[model samples]
Target: MDLLPLAVSSVIFLLVSVFLYSWKLNSSGTKLPPGPRGLPILGYLPFLDRNLHLQFTILARKYGPIYRLWLGSKLCIVVSSPSLIKQVVRDQDTVFANRDPTIAALLGTGGVDIITSPYGPYWSNLRKLFASEMLSHANLDASYVLRRNEVRRAIRNVQEKIGTGVDIGELIFVTELNVVMSLLWGGTFEGEKRDRIGAEFREKVSKFIELLEKPNLSDFFPVLARFDFQGIAKEMKDLLPSFDEILDYVINDRLKIMDSEQVEGELPSAKRGKDFVQILLDLKEQNVAEESMTLTQIKVLLVYSTTIT
Candidate 1:
């Protein structure tokens, strides 16, 4: 009786092990684009180079244009070649237009920004407003004076530092940040204040980008999502206060000017510049606006415009 029971237990263990192994293999075995085998859990994360574009180009040479990479458990399709990119992005535009709603996008956007919004009327309205107002040629022309002045200032500064040993990349980054700040704020700062604000804002923006780019295990492995291995939630909590502080300052400054005009009951023409904040405030006053449109929305829009430019 003892021998029979032992034999039964041994058989059961062998069968269970085989079943689990087969299940795991099958779960990982989907019809995906061919590429290197990812490690168990980490995926092909280790193989990824810091310069993603160049790395993808190199991979395209070996795995073709539309190769798949295992980012954690998620299957990431990489389209490197122009022809393939066009085919996926332009030829099948609608199918590719929607945001994927990954954890990173959700956290970065705070579930409201236009780019990360789902396809619907809300997104349509936001897109139309963005396209017609911010991206319009007229607005660009209006904003050109600010851009020109900032560029001139940057060129002069660069020329002054030509003989000195300086990192060109840092100089360019500062110039770009200054241009964006001028557009958003309707003025530029100088001296200590400029340096301090620039440093803080640059650090915040870099942290934001880093968080967005970091691989979340939850995105790949649904089961591991519960564990939050990437610590994305924690990172977001740390970054949110700084992000909110910057937005609050911009919003408060704009509001102060608007409030002062209202108190004086005067149409202050000289105080007017067609900045994004001004445009959004006007939209808010008009009441023909979507419910999702808020101060937060305006801030996010400004950020997107700056990043894109």
Candidate 2:
């Protein structure tokens, strides 16, 4: 019995050792695209600049249209040539279309929103909802008045600040926010509350964008993700709750309206007008697309439809 046990242990140890050795050999033999070398372990991470696009352009000129760099342990392939871009984005669209959602995006969206959701059945449904339901000519026509009013408000806002060198980007962002929110829910933010909320939203969104672009060690080194040394993931998770709370309020408020309208025996089409929330809610009630539509999915759609615009 002792000999049998010893022999079994020895065989297991030998198999484990052989597997590790083979894995090391395979990893060493794997080919990757060529680019500048960097320090051990850290890779080219320490030398990256804030203006990464400019650096990428210079590197592309030196390293050719396509090159790879190791950002920590993550291998990033950069394609600069128009032909290569077209190949990736067009010809092999499906093959290369899926995005690698960053830690921040995963937290912010709960890994469900259409933009960052992995390509699959759920993503397909979201796309169909956008193309078939939301972007229909009828819906666009219904939303025209809201867009026109918001555009007019933007014009007035700009006019009031005409002599003060108003920031054009800020003006456009506010205008888009107003238009998108109005179309999504058929409501407008106005007066002091609007100003306060708009400022807060812009600040939070700006910070979110910065964090999204900032390289997180967790991204390059999966082993370090749990530690979140940069706090990028935590910050994004915190910011998301505020936005979610706002979206929740809007969603619940719409639900209340839907309940009241149902009790009053008002047809949904008549009671809710042509806003996006109403349309989605109506679809929910029909129970026809149950697999494709869920309450969580609807909420995710509403959040992104307003903000992403």
Candidate 3:
């Protein structure tokens, strides 16, 4: 009588059978760490709390430091506790040291930023170039003047709001954000623009963090990983353009400086502070001479550098 439900059940049974067959074929005899029991289709997803960290921590306590949890069809290995963390981070560092795939990183970064990028020859080279060029001690020292000025401005803003019963959380976020923005973009926002950019960046960063920390069913269940049940892919597509616009502004401003025949030391007293952008541009030139760096690679490096710091 209920042929629709029967049909749906048949399809689900077929999928599960296929998945089990594949698992049996490829899975090694090596045993995974203990974990909570998972149900069909949903796995352990229904058991998980909305706050992933707390949920995992509870499981870690019960199941030991290393335990697996299923989010939908995917099985995720959660590593917790200080001792296990140290063992992975220090002892077996290399074996555990690999970046997640591009799609996974993109879900968290809104683009291919450096921090979430997988460990590879290209990533290694780009990281080294950034370290030696942009984040070097001399470069950081050069940018100190920018930091000082921005800090002073932040203090002044706080002073003005001393008795206005301002939101401490908002104030602190804006102050820290301005310091970072000045280091990266060479100026702080003011008036309405300040509030807007600060709010926008905060929201974007929060979303990115949320996406990264949450367990995706697709990430664990290779068979169903293609289906983005959480709408993570849609969110990434929407967020990337705004991120690109910010990056474009940084890159274009640096290029304008390079096009001007002005030497760094000869910069006016007011514009003397050299920021990360200048350092990255110089690295880009070096990369061109040593290896044929493409435009996309250069842009990727810049995007990565900005995201990390």
Output the number of the lDDT-best candidate. Answer: 2
- What's the lDDT for candidate 1? 0.72
Model 1, 1-309: lDDT tens digits are 469999999889878866664465467667656676665555688888888988888888898877877776566788887887898789987677787776766877776777888777877777877888776787666667667767898889878987788787987877787777666655324467655765677678778777777767677677776678779867867887887787777677777777888899965224344566666676777755666467778777766666665
Tell me how candidate 2 scores on lDDT.
0.74
Task: Give me the displacement of residue 226 in model 2, in angstroms.
Answer: 1.7
Better of 1 and 2 by lDDT: 2
**What TM-score quantifies how close candidate 3 is to the native fold?**
0.76
Quote the positional error of residue 235 for candidate 3 in Å: 3.2
The TM-score obtained by model 2 is 0.77
Any idea what lDDT model 3 has? Answer: 0.64
Candidate with maximal TM-score = 2
lDDT of 3 by residue, 5-71 (tens): 9999999998986677447323722677777766655667777777879888788789998987656
TM-score of 1: 0.75
